[model samples]
Target chain A: NAGVTQTPKFRILKIGQSMTLQCTQDMNHNYMYWYRQDPGMGLKLIYYSVGAGITDKGEVPNGYNVSRSTTEDFPLRLELAAPSQTSVYFCASSYGHGELFFGEGSRLTVL
Target chain B: AQKVTQAQTEISVVEKEDVTLDCVYETRDTTYYLFWYKQPPSGELVFLIRRNSFDEQNEISGRYSWNFQKSTSSFNFTITASQVVDSAVYFCAPLTGNQFYFGTGTSLTVIP
Candidate 1:
């Protein structure tokens, strides 16, 4: 079964460039989240959505943005890529308070 | 604020040896959930186990076991007779409301 799918597994961007990390789930879960993992660090939440049209900021929301237009899709946007934004991003979804299913992750590099 | 701590940064054990990973959490919410996830070299996360606040019973599955003690705010994972395939980074997460606060993770190496 296709749990969570993320596109552009790897991307390299120049300074001030912009890009979007796409995330979609086929499980029809309402809770979706975006997290970034830096080297030698834990995953930090960037944004989260309870349902379509409802979004909130998480621990490390700066330099990033997200939108959940449908129940299955939550895309993270980087307006002006910075070196600090280079990290592996993961998308996850859960049904209610159930277990979370994560994507394969997208590794981004900015120079 | 909720927090999860994995004091052990890295642990190395030979094959067929038992290894234990510690997880400590801090949360003010009376009702919460705890979870363990394994991230191998493939970079994909695999769910290990989930425990609720009221459940203190230790669980065992195959060579893996979990100890949950709400009194001490600790949920530890143990692998008996670990194989080389068990080498991975283990993360502990405590969920409160809709947010999950994850620990920094403990890297385990199962040498053969």
Candidate 2:
């Protein structure tokens, strides 16, 4: 079964380019989060949504935007790509603040 | 600030050897959830265990075991008779209130 699915497993973008990383969960979880992991580092929260139409910022949310239009979708947007933004992005969802199931991760590189 | 600390950046062990990954955390909330995830070369984060704050009991499943000691603010994971397949990155996370904190993850390599 597909738990949390992320699109474009790999992507390369130039500085100032823009793109959106897609995330969808079939478990119907209410809490969805966006996290980025740099080389040899742990995951850092970028944005999160408790449910549709509700979003909140996390520790590092400077260059990222997220929208939760539906229960299954929580997409993260990078309006202006930068070299510092190159990292592996992960989409995760949980039920009732429980264990989280993460996507396979989207590896993005900014030149 | 609530933070999860994994002091070990990397560890290498031969096959059939036992290994333990350390995780320390700080949280002000009365209730929280601690978890361990295994990320293999496939780059997928696989959930290994989840322990509640009130439950300080240790849990074991097959070759994996978790030690949750709330008194010490530590939730460590141990692997018995590790195999080559166990080589990967291990992450410890603690969820307090609306935020979940992750450590710098320990990379374990099992050489066969």
Candidate 3:
């Protein structure tokens, strides 16, 4: 169904390098979120958007940025990749307060 | 303050054995949603179940079941007769207002 699609399944970046993780959903959900998962630590929300052109920060919003330009797309940008930023990122979309449908995830490694 | 807690870090059970994953969450909001997610070795997240705080009845789906108790602030998941394919990491998450938080996931191993 291509519920939520994320590009760059895996990537490796050097310190100070920048990249964007692309995410798009076809479910027409209004709420979209970006989360990062480390080795053993739980998933931490980086940013979220309730609708187009609206974004908000979550628990660990540092060193990350997100933009919601359309109802079907929400992209997360790593302005300055750091060693601590090596983790897997997930993009999810939900219909209002409904269940969240997550993407396949993008794994990034920063050296 | 930690909103969701999964005390069990890892659990190993043989095939055809029952396993229960514990999840405890604390939230001040009366209206909230609790959910469980499964991440297998494939590195993809699968949504298992979603329960609202007001629903006091337990739910069963095939070999999977959920016990949601508001008095103890816990939402536990149990898998009956677990097979080798059931091995994966389970995460408990709670959504309060517009904020959603996930627990440190419990890794499960089903040995055949």
Candidate 4:
């Protein structure tokens, strides 16, 4: 089913630069989430979408934006990237509120 | 608000030895879900097991077992005859509705 897929597995951006982390799932899940994990720390949700055109902020949503235009795509945008935004980002999807299926993760470094 | 705590930062054990990772969570909702996920060095989170708050019955899956205790607000995972392949960071998470909260995680190293 390809499950969940994320593009740009690794990226490095300069301060003030902008980019989008792309995520897509073929499972047709109703829920999609974006999370960031610092070194040796737990994951903190950045944003989530219940369905197309419906989005909400999570624990940490600063410096980032998200949009769910369709059931298969949920993209996270980083505007004016900062050093604080350097972390491993993960995209996950699930049916309802059950167990989540996560992607391999995208490692970002902002200098 | 829901919070999860993993008191052990790191644990080390020899191969073939048993190890247990402890997790404690706090939530006001009577019906919730608890989960255990494993993240290997590759940085992919894999779902291991899940238990609902109402179901306190412990479950054993091959060499892996989980104990969920409602009274103590604890959900513990045990690995019997552990192997070097089991070395990874384990995270405990509690979910309420569509939101999920994760613990700090416990890193386990099984020395071969």
Candidate 5:
């Protein structure tokens, strides 16, 4: 089973562009999260969902949006990309809030 | 508000040597959880260990050990007889409820 899979391993977007980062997990976990990692910085939570149809803002949710429509998918949307939005995005799933399993990560570059 | 801190930004140790990574956290809440995660160049995060506020049990796993001191609000990890594969960025995170706060991370390089 593919534990967690993310789409578009790499992407480049111009300022004002919009895109979606797709995340899917086969574990049927109740919790899913979106995080971004900057250079020399640890992962910062962008958004999280406890279950399908439920989502909540996280520490660094200014430039992003998320939706959890099904148990297997939680997608993060960028409304207007900025240079600061260039970072590696990771999707994680867990049985609880503590221990998490992360994806390979989606590298995004905004120019 | 909760914050996690890793004082050492970078650490280097020769293979077969021992090294320790320090982590300190702050939060007003009476109960919380602390965690350590390892991320290599491959980009996936691997969870190393987790400790709650109440439990101060010092644990040893294989060649790795952790010391959790609630009084100092510190959770330290030590690697004994390090190997080249241990080179990675280690992150310390503290969690309150559903939110997790991560530190800047400590980059550990085990050189041959």
Candidate 6:
């Protein structure tokens, strides 16, 4: 059973390029999140969605955008990729605020 | 503001030895949750344990144990007879309301 799946496991983009990190969960969870982890760092929340059509910004939501059109998908978009945005992106989903099921991360490198 | 602190940035211990990873948190909310997660070299997060504010009882499962002290605002994790497979980066997150605060993480290396 694939709990949470993230697309583009690894990607490299030039500065000012744009890309979307796709995330989908099969667990029918209502809460979804996008977090970025820099090298040797902890996870920093970029955005989170409680349910379909409901989204909120977290600690670091500077250059990223997110849309939750359905319960199973929450995609994060980088409008203008920057060198500072080079990090590992993780998508997670949870039933409540308890244990979070995380995807196998997407590593992105911006030149 | 919510904050989780893992004082030890990195620790190296010989296999079969016990290791204790410290986690301290700060929050104004009286009711919150503390958790420990393990991220292996594969870069996937593995849930280790979760403790709420109401439960102060220390828990032990197999070789893993947790010490939760509310007065000190600490929830520490201990691994007895650490194995090579237990080598990973551990994170402590204190979640309050709808947000979570994660520490910088402590990298643990078990040497054979």
Over B18-44, each residue of candidate 5 has an lDDT whose tens digit, in order, gives 999999999888898888999987778
Worst 10-residue lDDT window, candidate 3 chain A: A95-104
What docking tier does model 5 reach? medium
lDDT assessment of candidate 5: 0.91
lDDT score, candidate 2, position B16: 98
Instruction: Find the 10 residues in a row with the least total lDDT in model 4 chain B.
Output: B93-102
Best by DockQ: 2
- Candidate 2 TM-score versus the reference: 0.97
Question: lDDT tens string, model 2, B1-112?
Answer: 5888999999999999999999999998889999899899878899988899998878899999989888899999999999999999999999988777989899999999
**lDDT digits (tens) for residues B1-112 of candidate 3:** 4489999999999999999999999999888899999999898889999998999899899999999999999999999999999999999999887768999999999999
Model 1 residue B112 distance off true place after TM-score fit, in angstroms:
0.6
| CA lDDT of each prediction against the hidden true structure | 0.94, 0.93, 0.94, 0.95, 0.91, 0.94
What are the candidates' individual DockQ scores? 0.79, 0.87, 0.84, 0.84, 0.77, 0.77
Model 4 segments more than 4 A misplaced: none
lDDT by residue (A1-111, candidate 4, tens digit) is 899999999999999999999999999999999999999999999999999999999999999999999999999999999999999999999888689999989999999
User: Model 2: runs farther than 4 Å from truth?
Assistant: none
CAPRI-style class, candidate 4: high
lDDT of 2 by residue, A70-99 (tens): 999999999899999999999999988788
Evaluate model 4: give its lDDT: 0.95
What lDDT, from 0 to 1, does candidate 6 have? Answer: 0.94
TM-score of each: 0.98, 0.97, 0.98, 0.98, 0.96, 0.98
Q: Flag clash pairs in model 5.
A: none
List of clashing residue pairs for candidate 6:
none
Worst 10 residues of 6 chain B by lDDT: B93-102
**Model 5, which residues run further than 4 Å from truth?**
none
Residues A49-90 of candidate 6 have per-residue lDDT tens digits of 999999999999999999999999999999899999999999
Model 1: which residue pairs collide?
none
Considering DockQ, which of the candidate structures 2 and 4 is the better prediction for this target? 2
